[model samples]
Target: MPERGARDLSPGTQARFDRFSPTGPKTSLLTVPGAVGAEVAGFTPVGDVMGCVVHQVGYTETSTWSADRIGQLADILRAGYQTALDRLVEEATAIGAHGVLGIDFTITSPDGLVQEFVALGTAVRATAGPRPRRPFTTGLPGQDVAKLMLAGWVPVRVAVGISGRAFTDRWGRPMVNEWVGNIEVPMATELATAVRTAARAEFTREIGDCGADGGIVSDLKFDLWPVHDVAVAAMATVIGTAITRFREGPVAPTSTLKILPLTRI
Candidate 1:
């Protein structure tokens, strides 16, 4: 598996790895305060890293777009995100970093059918203590990472959930009345709810897959557009960092902020 992972790296990425030296000066994307906070938490910034992928989406059937089609769309999106993230992790590993922090994702569709996903972050190495088998990844800022350590928890990885849907069934055909007065559309409401629920479920599954105790949701996004002027297509995304307990017993609270289950929104 490790060999396969290494083989998957692009030539450019491999060159980046070959040029990296542990004793050389490093670049970082963190602010001064963020760097200080990470240092206080026993980590030293190694370098800035990025990973990206461009995907082409194609539909097998060209009839009316439905929820089933949306499922395939979501699958393609999920693959793009995972591949990009995996490359990001590989870069961190090549640089000898124990983790990547303050990670952020960007997605853009240049055309109607082609999408690009990119992940960026600052890689860090532990100044002391044991490291995990694989480098951890997180979207938390440096200060937040420090606070989490003080609270006896450590970030595992970034978790993502995405779901897309289109409404074209019996309940959705009436939303296009040209002469009807403006009013709330039940079909739209249902579509939103369904997509959100599916996305959240996927997020939970991601957390579980990483063997984390729970997750801390960092963002939620939704997009909707009219499909052929007869149906509406919607996509929902949830992003968060999965975390696990490091200390056996309860630790002192880092702040007065409530410490409810991070998995719960």
Candidate 2:
């Protein structure tokens, strides 16, 4: 077995675990309704946890890049995001959390080559039932988690996938117009479609890696722009939570109402 503190946690984070206590005061990032929802689902909030990583990306320019080169850039960025999530899981383990809920990611790019990735969530413990060997994670809110559990599905992990593609004009090809007539940019459209397809494939692979049945996509973002005078580049990212069924077949609905209001009027 690997040593407990041998993970890549920072010095401060490691030290925090050194003085950890199970009975200490706890904290949570959930809203009041979220807290109640979690309680109803038989999960008790342990604490609010966070992980962060700042990395310097290697790719210098998108202008001269091919699809493969853009993919390499995405690989580097994916590493940063994975590292941040790993650290977050480590923190959750320190607090004996069975899982983390309502996870959110914050990414800031100071420049073209530097980025900081942060993951934040509320750690929780199952009030009853067998605990997992490693903590599970999800981007869904506590209320959504409760709903999922009631439906016999359980959150497995946060799934993320990113893909990038670059399209460039060949030699002697006519340059695409800059805000000219209403013309379809075939190259750009193809690049965008390719990136999105690859990103979703990657997202599905993430779910496979978790041994989950499927995933719930919460966010899909695409960034497309012109690079240099002859190239168009696109980057796509998909974020969601992988989930597995705990009980086979359809589950009975928890409420009969079609719409449940959050507040009493």
Best by lDDT: 1
Q: Each candidate's TM vs. the true structure?
A: 0.86, 0.86
Q: What's the lDDT of the predicted structure labeled candidate 2? A: 0.84
Q: TM-score for model 2?
A: 0.86
Question: Residue 43 of candidate 1: its Cα lDDT?
Answer: 96
lDDT (tens digit, per residue) of candidate 1 on 38-155: 9988999888888889988886665746656777888888998888899999889877789999999998997878889999999999989998878999998898899889878999
lDDT of each: 0.85, 0.84
Error of 1 at 186 (Å): 0.3
lDDT of 2 by residue, 47-146 (tens): 8888888887665454446656676768766887798888899988877789999888888997767788899999999999989999999988888899
Model 2 CA deviation exceeding 4 Å by range: 1-9, 15-20, 59-63, 66-69, 172-175, 249-265
List ranges where model 1 is wrong by over 4 Å: 1-8, 248-265
- RMSD values for the candidates in order, in angstroms, are 6.1, 4.2
